[model samples]
Target: MDRTDADGLFPRWIAHRGAGKLAPENTLAAFELGWRLGWRAFECDVKLSADGVPFLLHDATLERTTNGHGAAGARTWDELARLDAGGWHSPAYAGEPLLRLDRLAEWALPRGAWLNLEIKPSPGTEAATGAAMARAVEALWRAHGAGESGGPAWPLLTSFQPAALQAAQAAAPHLPLGLLLDHLWPGCWAVARGLGCVAVVLNHGLWTAALLAEQRAAGWRTLTYTVNDATRAEALLGWGLDGLITDRVDALGPGQPATA
Candidate 1:
């Protein structure tokens, strides 16, 4: 898919984080685990390090997800990189390095995996994080020649924060964006159109056959997140869900099932 085309902005299925439930979430090991399972597309969160480089992390604080204890953005990549990011998940994954977005892009591009980069800023850094991440993505896209003079699929960026979405659009107007909404909002379609979003990602709870039909009928691609149950996933697929972000990529088929 060309970077300019929204038609192929997403993949059939997205592993929640590298391997979702199969490995420690958001670590390089987990991503590789997903790759091992024949999955090419995955979703991961990106947050700015203290020096503004984008790095993979799912929380504002590193305590819960990694052995490190502190605000993720408060520490420079050099400092955060030294901490054990995978030990808490299990002894088998003690030294998983913090994944730089640039490195992840390098790794994923060769294998043709579509990335869904969720911009998750620290509490007050929405605009900054959004702008920074957008700039970073733009630079990477340009460097990789992901523009019209392209090679492979550029990542699809999404976020629940409108400010972040706006910033991303401004930073790289050409890069496709998606609106991540947890519920049906008033004029939600209008909002997504205004932001130039290529897709609408809903919280798993609010999804239904009716809503899916409504969005699909309107020519909008719809996706759900964090779904882990096989039966529910099958049901969503039957309802014509465009895609899913799941954790159990290794246990499921090629698309990888949802993560909890």
Candidate 2:
């Protein structure tokens, strides 16, 4: 598939976990806050609940963001839904519930927001989680993609787990896939190529002009995450990097030409 068109699918500056520290991460409130701050693109993480429902969340446990305890993947959607996802952030957001991926799709479908969905599988359920998440994404777009019901742009599916990315590829090859790397390693390029990924997301420290050139030379786009400083963001953009996922949605508004 010629996925070069996917290059134009995103902006240079993406809101990290939906406005990052501005609101409770991965909650609808966060995404809403990002939207209010002029973010047109966002990055998020997703995992399967005990009952196999896909939901937006980053950690393996719910203690950090929710009022619930124990492993997040150990609970059903109903049980997870009962948790207070925003109270831990502040009493101002006391009643936020676990955000389901489908519900998120519903919000984005009509709004034209671009999402970079990170396939964050639980420790032992990598393949299952990836397959399930991909299926849900495909179903959502099929029901809402452009010219069908006039949906927003389709999302880009990316992951750090090879098994997860592989399963997503097997389940939905038409969706743009990106391989994520926490650290640079030997044969990393081969791993991404093997999975048929069109892009590669890396930790900010791994970004370099040479690295960007190498990826470009091999016909792939390079993006980095959690960048919060202006100097580093400028340096990376100067290096010809494709995108920077940042927590500072406040500082890096979407109105700028680079972000536009």
The best candidate by TM-score is: 2
Cα RMSD of predicted structure 1: 3.4
Tell me the tens digit of each residue's lDDT in model 1 across 37-149. Answer: 78778899999999998999998999987888879999998998898888888889988878999988888877667889999988889989989998988887667767755
Q: Backbone clash tally for model 2? A: 0
TM-score of each: 0.91, 0.94
Report the lDDT of model 2 for residue 20. Answer: 87
* lDDT of every model, 2 decimals: 0.82, 0.85
- The C-alpha RMSD of each candidate to the native structure, in angstroms, is 3.4, 3.1
Residue 133 shift from truth in candidate 1, angstroms: 1.1
Model 1: residues with Cα > 4 Å off, grouped in runs:
1-6, 255-260
lDDT of 1 at 178: 88
Residue 178 CA error for candidate 2 (Å)?
0.8
Candidate 2 weakest lDDT stretch, 10 residues: 1-10
